[model samples]
Target: MSDAAGTDATVEISTDGACLGNPGVGGWGAVLRYRGKEKRISGAETETTNNRMELTAAIEALALLTRPSNVVIWTDSSYVKDGITKWVAGWQRNGWKTAAKKPVKNDDLWQRLLDEEKRHTVQWRWVKGHNGDHYNEIADDLATSAARNLRDAP
Candidate 1:
């Protein structure tokens, strides 16, 4: 959406992930805010890791943008924040291997994140989890609720 200034609105987003077990039912959630308008979205996967879900939340939210945008994403997962901001470039340069020469885990989501990131000017900020930050808490609730529902599904 464009602002009154005729420029693309900056989007503010908060994302989170949850799992019933480390590699069990996993869910991801994202809340996107643009020009005072907000959207909340969440999803689940039967077998996945929390880190993958976190990455998925960010990827899914950013994917909703139809054009390049200025976006800021707040996340509780250091894996998501640091992976994208601190580690991805090196990972790419090393052919998705870590400095220890080990293959990067969740390289698939990392690749997808990198692609989505290219379409926006994004700033990733890490927020401490369970700290009563409104947006983070909402995202966490959404993720946990989704995971719990999926886990309880018959």
Candidate 2:
């Protein structure tokens, strides 16, 4: 899609992540929409954290785009939003260290997310999880199903 200004138009996306245990089996899901078309994608990991899953959702969603476009990404994770939009610059400047000078957790994923983010113009929006938002609920279901699938796998 292209805006009137000749720039790539915005694609709306909703993403969510779920974990069977905080540091155990986890999954991420995303829904993307543009010009009345939609796509859903999801994946799971045998061992991970809720935060990692959350970040993964956004990463996977953005990575699916075939071209650089403006994107509005809806997520329930303040950590993903704040960490990327607010804190990442400082973390990069400090060699990926937190305020306490400790190494940042999930630095690898964060770096990957940042790399994917650079490919597009993304606006991060936060929605309350499980609050009955249609897309959010759908993404949640996808994530939960992925987690369950992984857990049930031999």
Candidate 3:
């Protein structure tokens, strides 16, 4: 069941992250769509990195599924995409350490993401962001909005 944009191959989800500065105010967003209905979710952090936001977006998206189903996740973050699809296994085998023998960054979120991922079959795809993809654009907007909201919060 694919959408007009060929995004419905499975329940299609897209996520984005934004940070005012590398480790400043940050936010993450996710857009989930299935059978014509769409849901958007976003959150902000007082201080965080883009990678953490990216992982948070993916984690939140998967958490929304709530049922066992195949899914395709689209994201602009190679860190999120590659980290889960490529590096996770090795990390698990190596006691969650990186190739450089350093502790993996964002281990908490990464572990949570791994746990949530087990609830569904997920395929990670990289999308070229800011190129006007509908879901991707929506996600980016939500992330920016969240970041702005965080910055403006009293």
Candidate 4:
């Protein structure tokens, strides 16, 4: 990977998640590419929501970075992008309640993502899912494959 302009080093990661059912088997996938090398990571949960898998993809990707660097994270989920960039602080201040005064959903995963994000210089980028973007497509494929594998497992 190329160094991001004005930055000493950079890593670009794309992530996606899939669920066989909203609260059923799910999988998360992430592609972490840097310094001309690429790594793909994925996992499956027997029972999970799509949003939870989405958050897991991001959390796992960031956890792979051992040191701080300028990082660009690409995802198709606006919930992830906006939740981290726009709403997390307010939620934290509100003791994990939404602006509507309801307890935040998936606060555990959100908190994990927040912790991982704080360890790096992160830029969140949103892409349209199922689009032709190469990395995003790969991530999506990996997620779907993982989910399928889980579904097929005895």
TM-score of every candidate relative to the true structure: 0.94, 0.95, 0.92, 0.94
In the predicted model 3, the residue pairs found to clash are none
Sliding window of 10 residues with minimal summed lDDT for model 4: 1-10
User: What residue runs in model 3 are displaced by over 4 Å at the alpha carbon?
Assistant: 1-9
- The model with the greater lDDT, 1 or 4, is 4
Q: Candidate 2 has what TM-score? A: 0.95
Tens-digit lDDT track of model 4 for 1-154: 4344356768999999999989989999999888789999999999999999999999999888777768999999999999999999999999999999999999999999999988778999999999899999999988989999999999
Q: What ranges in model 2 sit over 4 Å off?
A: 1-5
Q: What's the best-to-worst order under TM-score?
A: 2, 1, 4, 3
Candidate 2 positional error at 48, Å: 0.3
**Full-model lDDT, candidate 1:** 0.90
* lDDT per model vs. reference: 0.90, 0.91, 0.88, 0.91
User: How high a TM-score does candidate 3 get?
Assistant: 0.92
Across 65-115, the per-residue lDDT of candidate 1 in tens digits comes to 777888899999999999998999999999999999999999999999989
How displaced is residue 24 in candidate 3, in Å? Answer: 0.7
lDDT of 3 by residue, 25-143 (tens): 99999998887778899999999999999999999888877567678899999999999988989999999898999999999999999999887778899999999899999999999
